[model samples]
Target: MAVQQNKKSRSKRDMRRSHDALTGPTLSVDATSGEKHRRHHVTADGFYRGKKVIDTGSNE
Candidate 1:
């Protein structure tokens, strides 16, 4: 019988996701595209500040 492997176990793409191709703090994904949405890319200073607040549920 064939075995199923975890996706992350497979070779990861050397290319950074287009989403991370920008300056931001957290990354979100498009609801449908299944692509990484480059949003909230901010500097550590701004991130800690009120630049953008509220719990995004991200480990931050």
Candidate 2:
């Protein structure tokens, strides 16, 4: 078993854990569709920045 020879300082520990906190992805609502989607990402319907670029086939 490995043992710690020295204690980790508070500042060092905090800095290391700074990115450990869970955070929800930043999302923005589409003005046209009124749907919430992540920034810089296309909506489920394949729309990006208010433009329909992809053809999401209908699930008929």
RMSD after CA superposition, every candidate: 14.9, 2.5
TM-score of model number 1 = 0.23
Clashing residue pairs, backbone N/CA/C < 3 A, model 2:
none
All candidates: TM-score: 0.23, 0.66
Candidate 1 positional error at 35, Å? 0.2
Model 2 TM-score, 2 decimals: 0.66
Instruction: Report how far off residue 13 is in candidate 2 (Å).
Output: 3.9
Candidate 2 per-residue C-alpha lDDT over 1-60 given as tens digits, one digit per residue, 9 for 90 to 100: 999999999999999999999988999998779999999999998889889988889766
Candidate 1 per-residue C-alpha lDDT over 1-60 given as tens digits, one digit per residue, 9 for 90 to 100: 977575452235434343466554567654434455446443332332234433555675
